[model samples]
Target: MPHDQLPTQAHAFLRQRHNELGIPGLARRWREVRAQIRANGTWRPTYDELAYAARVAWRNSGRCIGRLRWPSLIVRDRRHITTLHDVGRELAAHLDEATNGGRIRSVITVLAPATNAGPPPVRIISPQLARYAAWPSREGVLGDPANLALTRLATDLGWSGPTRRGPFDLLPWIAATADGVLHLLPTDPMHILEVPIQHPNHPWITDLGLRWPAVPVISNMTLTFGGLWFPAPFSGTFMASEIATRNLADEHRYHQLPAIITGLRLDDRDRLRTDKALLTLHEAVLYSFEAAGVSITDHHRESRAFARFAQHEEAADRVVVGDWSWLNSYPMTPQDPSWSRYYHPGQPTPALLRDPYCLALTAGHPKPGHEPSPRQRADVPPGRCRHTQPRKGGHVSTRTPVKAHRRLTRLAAAAVTLAAVTAGLVGVSGGPAQAAGCRAAPYSAKFGAADYFMQYDGVEVISYPKYPSYYRTTSQCRDIQVRNTGDGVDFGPFYACVNFYGRSGCNYWTYVPVGQWRNLATNVKDGTKFYVWVRIDMGKYYGFRAVGDW
Candidate 1:
């Protein structure tokens, strides 16, 4: 590889660390990293600071400095972006005893309530707790604000199922099973939902100049909610409340809710922040957790941090058994000790940040939303790693690997040819020009249950001597296409959109477009470092392709 073919700083650090001591490397064994980088790469490697650094860099991307001065763009409600999260949270069972069967399933969840209260108003249970779950209201089950609203959420959203006779009474078959739980607790916080939900179809405006930007979730502190096992949505935009609500009432309600949950906040209109650490708001806090960037956990060593989260999660589940929905219901809300103890006015929720297993999807950690901060721009140079194809019969495969990419890229490329103009990307530009093509995973045979994982012909491109792990561009974009080359692969438009680091030589581009714009919902940019992701999903023996704005 030529000098120009070097990986981006971030990618380089990841690869180096992967090869050096391996991720989660022991302190002493990996302690020599600083010396390692000093002797080789451009800078010294930082430790115990990945999230901290990402937080710093992402926040400083010049995106957060102002009050979000972008045009108020609305993509309209699509199948994927328009989830009834608020309604789901409201309708979910906070306790396990009040349900028809009296139990919520024990599983991961994303909680996107209109506001926060004592604790998460919704409760998702695991199978163990599911057996002991309960509904929020039992007996005659009067249409209380919560149950009525929640049930409406199910019906109005057109969720597939039987009768929506109250979320607790999840009509037999509909209530049978769920991937996880959604919690909705309404607090009188100065929320924006009250504005939008109050008028979902009506056009509204925010202090951020966003007109009817229904889904502007805050990022950092926003993602922090998932640290406590909370799932929020997309961006950290503002939620509009009604005029009747009092600013004092909202603040009072904010204070009334669980400090732990309520404390999880986002950067509101008052962009007043503390640079000592990143200042974030609700959705942003949630998105921080939803962030994805190369899986931190590798095949080697052990995830000591993961073990701790598992233990805590288990203990919490045990204490939450029974029809305790009543225990923390309406007037009798109780505080959670764990969150209370760790509550700091402005501090990263390490507890949530460290544990990405249960909260990965909910928090959006290994997904979209999480972007790199500016500070992280200064990193060590990247290097080469060995690549191999899936081995057959205990030997590396002699067959050539198929090239794969997100479907939209190819579609967009075709469209570009038809349209005869490249809009956003400037073609693959950081390294020497190499013909566009796909390469096989070098270490496929090493996969234990290779069948379980999705395989693709990951394309390797060279541009101007830079080796971007993924594809990218500078133009705005005109067309993006994708191709499915597998048989009966359960893949949909899962891999379509991507995020790229803009280069004023400084900032990269990042967008959270809705699923309807393309097809897939899987984020191609989350785990990426420098290049924009041309996401693709190909099942066994099949390959995927992508071509967009190149």
Candidate 2:
């Protein structure tokens, strides 16, 4: 790679670390690295630096809620993997150690960076080593809808499936090597941990036949450090809701809720039914994982962890860039302190960046010439195939905004819980509810199911509605709010919006600061009323309007 291709500060970062950490190999490598930088302006990091970079990426992951454990990340140096088969072998070991027979550990295996300044020589097409197969059948599709395209890629790569396919069938690993040779490796059943879900309170849920892999090992992410890109596969234990709400109950996936709704005899017509089902389903995941002695974290526990992380970062004067929606996606999002505030997502630094091959496969595009495309890649499906096709594959499949909706519903439910709790609640013994003089209610209410709000004694909570994920859409329009004291006096439009759907909206207050005794309400006290106006618009796609008087 040319010297300019390397980040301008790459050498500086390495040199500073050399002087600070004083690691043995770094000084000698630093001399060689600088020589290469002078000759070609690009250099490779030593083994120790690679390990440091991997850990830094974990520490800087904004979308991940479990970042507090970044220090415990285990980085395995596998940069010498020269064969595609070896990639699979290492990945299997990754799964084995990551799962750790249910005592999961966060781990990453870093492969050699792209050499000769070319695209990655080896790439894993699968998002994770273990994912359910989405098989096409006369009756209907089986397994996770997310993996439909990759499933076809595996089959075409000479992978034979069981005669009787079930929803839990794991897909084989697919990779492309330096010589552009593609290899398919069947997933080892023993290396994968699939936990059957059973509700502690509702044992009948076991009959629903639900199970999910224990660890989420993400491959196909390019780990860039000191201006070099390493194909690193990393693993982390699943948040219970990631399995319950997304992999299982998502509309395009197992669509588990309809059955649960029927089993619980709840009315599906009402949107609240979905919320109830999600809560119960998530509960089952936590309970079952615990019963089976599998590692898992609930949303609340993770939120608390995030709070501590934020505080620690703040103490060090570090800016905590966060995707509010993602961080607040737990079943009880609104009640969490993290959701009540706003954050700036500065940048994705030292993080596990998405790979083109991974996105292509995710978009239903298989590797070119690796295997016959199940659906020819020529006819790209809008919305489904975000990237161009690698080879032939079936028609592009549509992914529902279920993942985004999952986050949205969580925030919405939290808002409802907040309102109920704020209105006043009795003690555990069922005494009469009591409240202080002040009352807080949701403001600028529109986008019914998407709107979220919370109010504590002195502070008010408001969340601008946002889209599901940036993967499917990019239009992030502004939301407006205004307040007035009856007459001509008014506070003009205050605007807020989120750039990416996967992120949270900017902050805006409909009312002004309260400390001034010459307040508008106090000044115009005689027979005067206060009014506030709020509007939300999404570029003519969706609009909401509301006005309130007090």
Candidate 3:
């Protein structure tokens, strides 16, 4: 659409520029833009206009929680670059400048914008300039499950990864030009600043060998302003939670929590073990980045900063719009100031918008008819990539030999099992009385079995201790009843016991059917603690609740 025909957006942006920056002669500039649009059906944004618009786009981004530094964003206007080679070179330069040797700086490189003549001159196909490759096999996904499609697409484009693939393998950059050509460019390892994840308190965490990029450069979103779309790639130092809580801890992503919990050897007897593990992971991510001199922020600090940003916006008579879900951190606590407040909840231009073609390309599925031909495959030679090279300072290379990688995998698996067994004890709550005068608390267990139908060969145990002040005893209670709360097949013939430390005196095993309660006889004692042991025949998950008269 011509800017002269629908001049509302163009006029709004220009007026904002005038109001905020006090740029004189706004009416004269608008007339010039109108004349350009009348003659050529589109108007070009001057470098000054483009830079300010990019900064304003960050300010208007509803999903961003770090908009406090909007005015400090460094914008690179590369509107003249039209070739894929130049795009690759500029991207490498962007990484070097933004990374800044671990003291990351926020930067955005704005390429050619979409015009009436054609689409953007160059478009980045990767979701982030720095992302790991995901190679799927019969065993499991070797890298990130989230990037499997993209990994497969890269391989199909003749970009074979290292001779021995391991997790945390950096993917090659993919770019497409207006002439329908695809280019696969290798990322220079020196430019990719990586921080090895290690916990300050837990030294064993380093053994797992996890690392993350210092700066996250988002490449797939378009910077929309004044009725034009620019394929802009932007970067900011990571927020610790984005790496620890989401990227590494999410089940569909790296899923490192279970391993971390196992390494911590936290007793499952504590009801908050999972939460503790998550916090520990967050601390490790923060510590690792800080130790490496990489710029990072914790959730609490970022939330407080955002609160201040909102205050400043309100002071300026600007309505703060934000997506509440995105603004708050995962594993969020009420202590954060952002937890209690609300904001105007809609997206407003100028904004960074996700284009469908970019999304598809990032997902490893290009536009159906635009698939690259045989000649378009750009594969790098094996030894030429620096990721496969040995580190200079006696540091271990990320690319482990295939045999060593398998051995490490086996050790990790063993550690997980041992951790589960060592911390097998569960906690149950004593709450309000249910029917038959029994106080119940809900409990659930995650089976370690990989197959859904296969039975977890290990025993699932729960204990109510006597020494802990918070623990409830069966002294006042007579009989204990257990109800199967799971949706899967029935479980148990539970063994109820009264124990002193490791020794136990128990009764005969009593069976409990699905959704039904079974009263099991227990020998109540003053000093001994109560315990329940059950085994499920099928399913990867089990849920139950125990009720006793207290």
lDDT of each: 0.22, 0.55, 0.63
Q: What TM-score, over all chains together, does every model reach?
A: 0.19, 0.64, 0.66
Which candidate do you rate higher for TM-score, 1 or 3?
3
Query: What 10-residue stretch in candidate 2 is worst by lDDT?
Result: 468-477
Model 2 sits at a Cα RMSD from the real structure of 18.3
Tens digits of per-residue lDDT, candidate 3, 459-545, equal 233333212212233444455545554444333333333222222122445665555666655544534333343333222233333
Relative to the unseen true structure, what is the C-alpha lDDT of residue 540 in candidate 3, on a scale of 0 to 100? 27
Cα deviation in Å at residue 46, candidate 1? Answer: 11
TM-score, ranked from best to worst: 3, 2, 1
lDDT (tens digit, per residue) of candidate 1 on 1-550: 1222222333444543355334665454344644453454322223333333333222222112111211221111111212334323322322211121311111112343212222223222111111101133555332222122223222221222323432222211011102122212221122222111111221121122111212222211112321122322223222112111111012311111122123334244434322211212232322322231101111111123223333443564411111111111111112321111111112222111211111111111111212222122222122110000112222111011211222211221211100001112223333212223321222101100011221111211111111223343212222222232223333223233323322101111122122223322223332232332332222221222222222
Q: Rank the candidates by lDDT, best first.
A: 3, 2, 1
Q: Report the Cα lDDT for candidate 3.
A: 0.63
Query: Could you tell which candidate, 2 or 3, scores higher by lDDT?
Result: 3
List per-candidate RMSD values in Å: 23.6, 18.3, 22.0
Regions of model 1 farther than 4 Å from truth = 1-53, 56-179, 187-190, 193-215, 218-550
Cα displacement (Å) at residue 442, model 3: 47
